[model samples]
Target: MGCLENLNYEILAKNCSFKETRDIVKRMCKERYEIPPGFKIVGKGVVGIPPIHVGIREEKLVCTYTKPCHGTFVILVDSPEDIEQVRKNGKPVK
Candidate 1:
């Protein structure tokens, strides 16, 4: 796994829209990454589900807005090993 300090990344604004996040990923992430269809950063939450979601998709870090009232955001991880850090804190998508 690559060290966190070794990975180049930025935590996008919480107000960033899902579309904006996707666009950023496409433009920034240089690896084969996927943001699942219907992926939402902020929306109606399930009782047991978290309002904020974080995970790794295709080696890239993907996350939702931190609060229900906020919008989505993005974190650009530089290595596939970075996936481990995400999984430690959240679940993985299919």
Candidate 2:
């Protein structure tokens, strides 16, 4: 398996629709990586704050919005390795 296989990712956002977030990520993967079918969103609504869902596809970890919150936020990570890279790069996850 690739290094990114079965990775986990977290999504942080405010005031956003889950469906909209999922659609946006689907579009991005299709346009940029030519990923077919796209990632699968799993899990139920999270209590407090916005609901967050988790799933995996083609070794890429994906998190999606399930509840609405203020402000818009989005993020993507290939693997735990990539998470570190994102942190090291000083890119805000929120």
Candidate 3:
């Protein structure tokens, strides 16, 4: 199953608030990309923000967003391979 689909959203929702979830996602991105968590890319102005939301589905964390200037952003991945799959499918990665 997909990472996001395997996530336990119920547990994540109960243990972490929306803000906390966003923070964790940002941190993960920061660590992965070696940049600041809120750094802007492709004119998005940040990896997580307004129109950009983060949440947990099943037992995985999910990040999605839409930007007036950059179009849309939707990424659902658990590992680097999944990320590559999403990109190969022409979807955003975050």
Best-fitting candidate, measured by lDDT?
1
Stretches of candidate 2 off by over 4 Å are 1-14, 31-60, 65-73, 78-94
TM-score of candidate 1 on Cα atoms, chains taken together: 0.40
What 10-residue stretch in candidate 3 is worst by lDDT?
Answer: 7-16
Compute the lDDT of residue 68 as modeled in candidate 1: 51
On a 0 to 100 scale, what is the lDDT of residue 62 in model 1? 49
Mind giving the per-residue lDDT tens digits that candidate 2 earns over 14-84?
A: 45555565555555443122111222222222222322333334556444433343543444545654323
C-alpha lDDT of all candidate models, in order? 0.44, 0.38, 0.38
List model 3 lDDT by residue over 4-87, tens digit each. Answer: 345322222223433554565565443222223343332233344333444333334345433456543444434443334323
* Whole-model alpha-carbon lDDT for candidate 1: 0.44
Better of 2 and 3 by TM-score: 2
Positional deviation of residue 7's Cα in model 3 after best superposition, in angstroms:
9.4
Give RMSD (Å) of candidate 3 vs. truth: 10.5
| Candidate 3 lDDT for residue 91 | 23
Report the backbone clash tally of model 1: 0
- Give per-model TM-scores: 0.40, 0.30, 0.27
- Model 1 regions more than 4 Å off: 1-10, 35-66, 77-94
lDDT of 1 by residue, 10-30 (tens): 575557766665455445444
After best superposition, candidate 1 residue 79: deviation in angstroms? 8.5
